[model samples]
Target: MDFGLPKERTSLKIPPALGEEVQEGRVALTPQGVRELVARGHRVYVERGAGERAGFPDAAYEEAGASLVSREEAFGRGEVVLKVARPTLHELALLRPGATLMGFLHLAVAETGLLEAMAEKGLSAIGYELMGEGPRRPILKAMSEIAGRMAPQIAGRLLEAPLGPGMLLSGLPGIPPADVVVLGAGTLGRAAARAFLGAGASVYLLDKELSALEEASREAPGAITALITQSRLERYVAFADVLVGAVAVPGERAPVLLSRELLARMRRGSVLLDFAIDQGGVAETSRPGIYQELGVTHFCLPNVPALVPRTASHALTATLLPFLLQVEDDPLKVPALRQGAYLLLGQKGGHLE
Candidate 1:
């Protein structure tokens, strides 16, 4: 079988600075990923200590045939820039005009200034979150799986005293387990249901679509599945010890499902983990970091996987490598890549939908 590999490979850059305001330890390309790109004859320039936070030393990247370059050279010389988070304004300024940028560029919820800057630079930007067609989001799925699996542990810790009511997620032999209400029956929700179930919590998974709910039921047999109705949501939210917001809408901001009025009904000291915060969150009160609002502890960090940088970086590398390869030549030729092009060269906004 003839795999259509590009005859002329492109120069790729991996920068050290994370795009988000918060400290993100995960790097876009790992040493292993660089090795594969180099094997295919691509030139890879890695910024010094780019993968240090993710536990991949500079020596590993060097062994993989990546040139250790300064930040300026990495961003200035590459035809394509690979990043883990959306580029901050400072990092965005460093990119050469018309360079292709591939990363988790959440343009839907991005600041207008950032969008304008990209357009002014005439850059081509591809968002990993918006890459695939329905149910085919490889990069998003990998990150969501990591975030979902970590939810139970984070919630369990938050449920302890000082931050919470000092309740155990598993409860005692006679005591009832904590109720975990997971919104959205998508990949993250299903994974969260399984994790919460394993943690001995009573899991209730909800979604607007019956098909998604049915799928979640099959994936997590013991968890209860329900259609998200106003009455049902109110009842569940009122009693929920932990409310997890995993809802998402591809290429758009996450719809606000829980209003302040509804959130106010939750018991004092209850926890709310809004995984959808990256897409503007599923709750009206959810913000882009951990805090207390309306007597509820809210954990709404946009980059949850950054907590486990080593694992997250490796997983990201595996899922992103194939897409990176396809874009080396003509990105628009690939259906997924074309679909993910939020901002095309010399344009302010490409196809968002």
Candidate 2:
């Protein structure tokens, strides 16, 4: 599993930090991951309490051969920095110049200032979302499965009294079940359809690609699949009690499917769960996290899996460990690492563009 890299390239000085203040509940690496890295001769710096929220205590990391250091030391000392979310302004400023930064760096919708700062600092940045070309995004798929499975449960809660019309997702014996319309037929969309169907809701899955629809149908058999068009989208959305926007395009902004006008036509008290918010959202009104507008509940959090931190962290580590092991001083030298990278040595958009 060296991926054909030279012996020296397998070892890296890595720091797994989530910053001084924990913005995300998930940690990039678990204690088990650290132990594996350490056995391979990498120096792992675990920021004090970095994995606490994800249920991995400082003592656990210490026992696994990680040095629990202060936040500043963790960020400043490592040749490569690992994180869950994109770094904040303060966190970005703390990185050592020329250090390699890896995480879910969603650069498409990121601020211009943030991109410029990374360039100025001479950092190499890799995004989890962009990892592996042509539908082989392992990291993105793992997280998307979590978010999609969570959507139905979250929608059920939001559909209760006070927040939404007192309607059950799985209607009573004589009553009709809730109508769930999901946009996109990709990983997240298919998962959502399966979960909602399991919850006893009637699911309608739509995508522009017929092949994707066919695949989703086989995965979630009870779902009613449709080709996305203006007429069909408007029709299904209007009938939806819970509308899920699970649409995504790799390395680009999510396509906006629902306009404000289209959204306004939906029944009052309906719920809109936009899983695509990380890549600019599938609805025009979507903003990060939950909000209320026009009598509809909007849960547009970019990191929905964060709600289940312990589970999310373990899943992330399992998928990310191999990639972390592949990292070398110069990431671009590795083919898989280069595909995932958006910035290399302060320069953006050479291979990435």
lDDT of each: 0.83, 0.81
Candidate 1 structure quality by residue, lDDT tens digits, 1-353: 00111111112221222223445778877888888888877888888888887798889999998888887777777777877778878777878888877778888898779888888899889888877765599989999999999999989988888788999999999999999999999999999999999999999999999999889988899999999999999999999999999999877899999999999999999999999998999998987767788999988887788878899999988987887676456565677776778888856444553
Q: Scored by Cα lDDT, where does model 2 land?
A: 0.81
**Residue pairs with backbone overlap in model 2:** none
Q: Each candidate's TM vs. the true structure?
A: 0.91, 0.92
- Model 1, residue 255: what's the lDDT? 90
C-alpha-based local distance difference test score of model 1: 0.83
Could you give candidate 2's per-residue lDDT for residues 209-273 as a string of tens digits? Answer: 99999999899999999999999988998889999999988778999999998999899999999
For model 1 the local lDDT of residue 158 reads 83
